[model samples]
Target: MTPITSFFRNLEAKCCAACGQMIHEQAESYATECAPCQEQASFDAYKYYHQKR
Candidate 1:
């Protein structure tokens, strides 16, 4: 198998996989989603339906 180091580029910044937003160098190490996406991460379509029960 190829080494893990050869799999991905050592990037300073990259776009979010889900939302295509810029993740800066400081947050790239841990951030999978940007602030806007992260803030709304709990959004569920069934939430409103469940609440009515």
Candidate 2:
């Protein structure tokens, strides 16, 4: 797949846009942080719940 397609595919897999953490699909759209990462990334909160640990 193309690089762009591969990136979005990662989103479908609930991967963090910033840290590549695996998380819930529900947190895919408009998100980049999992629960743990979100907590620490309060400065730049990732909409997603699958943030890095």
Q: Compose the digit string of candidate 1's lDDT tens values, residues 1-53.
A: 86656544554567787799787656327778777776676565457668889
Q: What is the C-alpha lDDT of each candidate?
A: 0.67, 0.66
Candidate 1, which ten residues in sequence have the lowest lDDT sum?
Answer: 4-13
lDDT, residue 5, model 1? 62
Those runs of model 1 whose alpha carbons end farther than 4 Å from true positions after fitting are 1-12, 25-28, 43-53
Clashes of each: 0, 7
Candidate 2 C-alpha lDDT tens digits along 1-53: 56976666665467766688787856336676677777777645654444675
lDDT (0-100) at residue 31 of candidate 2? 71
What value of lDDT does candidate 2 attain over all alpha carbons? Answer: 0.66
Q: Which regions of candidate 2 are displaced past 4 Å?
A: 1-11, 43-53
| Highest-TM-score candidate | 1
Candidate 1 C-alpha RMSD relative to the actual structure: 5.1
